[model samples]
Target: MSTAVTRLFIPRDTTALAMGADRLAREIAAEADKRGETVEIIRNGSRGMFWLEPLIEVETPAGRIAYGPVDSQAIDSLFDQGLLQGETSHPLCQGLTEAIPYLQKQQRLTFARAGITDPVSLDDYQQLDGFNGLKKALQMDGQAIVDEVKASGLRGRGGAAFPTGIKWQTVLDAVSPKQQKYIVCNADEGDSGTFADRMVMEADPYMLIEGMTIAGLAVGADQGYIYLRSEYPVAHQILNEAIDKAEAAGFLGDNILDSGKAFHLEVRLGAKAYICGEETSLLESLEGKRGMVRAKPPLPAIVGLFGQPTIVNNVLSLAAVPYILSKGGQAYADYGMGRSLGTLPFQLAGNIKRGGLIELAFGVTLRELLEEYGGGTFTGRPMRAVQVGGPLCAYLPESQWDTPMDYESFQAVGAALGHGGIVVFDDTVDMSAQARFSMEFCVAESCGKCTPCRIGSTRGVEVIDRIRNDEDREANMELLEDLCETMIYGSLCAMGGMTPFPVQSAVKHFPEDFNQPAQTNGAQS
Candidate 1:
């Protein structure tokens, strides 16, 4: 008689690996062998509950039970306490995986398959409705597919908040002389404290593939490219592997599913440039040119990527297409508040406990995420400032924390929910220095193609230094504001345009920081 084999799952995501998951996996196997028991280990993606990384799930009659932050040293104790049988008596046992409050509360539409299956398994992907969107898109006309996206009320999740469907419709309606169009997925996610795009690429790569394939069908594009950041070595490898697997299974490449419709996809590594996160700059980098912003008149939809019409979208926006196609547009439209339909995967990071990804509907307040999901600051100090969006975004005070997280709501408060990267800061943070760093960051990353960004950022830094040093403080403060206006309106791209957001917000919300007494040796208190 054959003995029944026990199944165990450990995450192979970057976070888990950083926490020594591979070592833990080896130890578990050795312990099982010493006991003469049969065990199967499956490396799955992370569930985004980063605090409990290397979370091991044992398949039981009840369900997958969770135990986490597990190390090699704990393997012996865990097994002795009936870990294989999903016993909850162990100190590390977190009960059933699905019942965890952090994971249970998330809507998880785009991230549905994330952490639930093997990252590169095509079978695992198909079993969970992976290519259903592409299957449906193959049957519908291009116009119909575009219409579905329009009705879904989806906007760009890459911080711009532009209507995605309208951009698709533009590409669909554009006339290409060379009969060529492109679908570019901006995977160069350079925003500070953001890892949602990397999580999708590493945890559920096929979702991005399926979403991009549907985009090809919707916009009549035959080729797609994922401009991934060079920093993400793991994501690059996994994306390439998933693409190979998908193509072999007939989900990508020419004559997909034998429908005679063709779509080919490839992954290209980007040069380490923050400016490349901008769509036009990304296109320039893809074309082997200097990554510089292109002026808008003939939008990318009409003229892009070797001068052919192109559809450029963030990874989350494209990843969302699969769901919009599978469950009708209105189905997705039913989730969020007015205009900001569908769920957003908010990535919590910085000085916060319980930091990870939380996908919720639009109307959720920032206070809810910080308090309930974040559980307050990791240092246990009073929370001071919160930077939503990226380095270019404003530093919000406690008063603005109550605002809803949608595009318009954030916009109304002179803030943005850019890429859903929320970075927390404790009371020890120096707001004036942070504001200065924003200008300095622009100086370091600017492409020098525009004067406002290139020169204004350098001057802005000098002015902020003067303010901090108490050198004609009143005159310099006024000069700083005037210079910010120049950069805001005179810059060629958001690189220059949005640099003033953090500096202006710091002076507005935390004036005390800027008005501090001058230090003796440039030392900050």
Candidate 2:
């Protein structure tokens, strides 16, 4: 008689870790051992459904069944409930993992392997069609790979929406030794409502490794670095593990796959500077300098990282390359609306029922995400406004919920999709307070490299305070608008350039909030 080993999956993603998944995992293993049962526990990444984290899954003949928000004390009960046999009688039983509506709705191109495979497991990643893109890339020349990315219409997912292929082509075209050129990934995902980058790094680090390898091959660079945010300790550990594993497997470093191609990748922690999210500023931080913005013209594509031509891409943008190369660029291009092609991993945060990640084609309406996926505000109050693309983006009211989640469409509405982060706010939210907070955030986070962002943000906050206190309300309003215009065009980078978005949007959409008496804690009345 053959004894079967029960397979159990637990997430080690940061959110799950914060929810005590590590303790739950150890407890589950202890209980299984105490019961004289054989169990194979695998630590996977979060499913992006954060509310259901510590989500445990068991492999059954039928499929993987899920039970979530599992507590350490519940481990014995789960085992007693025949969890190894995939029993569905437990109160936390969520049935088939894939059937969860929140996950089912996402297109998940860039995040295809997240939450499914063991994070840092080279074997598991390979089994799931992982390096097919790198294999395909190995068979093609540099121009061919760049052309493929261009055909896919992939823009930088870090918020700029600049064509990624064009950036690669610049580095490819620059007159520099292959060794001098570099590939830098901006993993400093500090924006509010954003964790897609963190999830990708923690869940499927190899996908990023493979993608960065492809970028190196295409851009004639053999070295790469991921400037990750220091806040994500879990991601740092997972990425380092994946890198070591990949190097040992010959998928990274020194003659990869014995194909005579060589690429090396490493992770460097950012100084927790929000301005470092900018391409040039990130380059500065990567070189051990203070994180600050650099002037354009000699763009990062021309001079970056050690003053060599570099290809800087966001984590999601690099993560998308494997899919584009494997499935063919046209397949990805066919998914989204005009101009913005391929999938975008939209993060739902703030006051929302289902706050997690949703990767979809670019044209989905905000109303669908808010009403259907998010299920409205977590406070159970009506959603007053939604901030699309982080704190630097505009505060969109309910009236603008129909706007499409695309670069051009968002721009058409006088907003920029800084990053695919949507922060929902309830009716009790004060747009005026939010506007002030935007300036305050900029004030605190600014690199102090430019006057408009460093100084203008301070003045903007004071102006909002005056308006809130009803001191020269009308005149201050006009002055605030003028100041915003200067910051929008005068600031060195998006840190100051985009800070006015929330301020402008607030005054435009919810003027009544500004006129009302200031509430305690500096919130709206």
The CA lDDT at 433 in model 1 is: 86
> Where's the lowest-lDDT run of ten residues in candidate 2?
516-525
What TM-score, to 2 decimals, does candidate 2 have? 0.97
Please list the residue runs of candidate 1 whose C-alpha ends up more than 4 Å from where it truly belongs after superposition. Answer: 1-3, 518-525
lDDT (Cα, tens digit) per residue for candidate 1, span 1-525? 333788899888888888889888998998999998889999988999998988999988888999987987788889999988888998889999999999999999999988889999998998999889989999999999999999999999998989999999999999999999999999999998899999999989999999899999998999999999999988998999999999998889899999999999999999799999999999999999999999997899999999999999999999999999999999999999988999999999999998999999998999999999999999899899999999999989999999999988999999989999999999888887888899999999999999999999999999999998889999999999999999999999998999999999999998988887545323255
Clashes of 2: 1
Q: How far is candidate 1 from the true structure (C-alpha RMSD, Å)?
A: 1.8
With candidate 1 superimposed using the best TM-score fit, by how many Å does residue 283's alpha carbon deviate from the native? 0.5
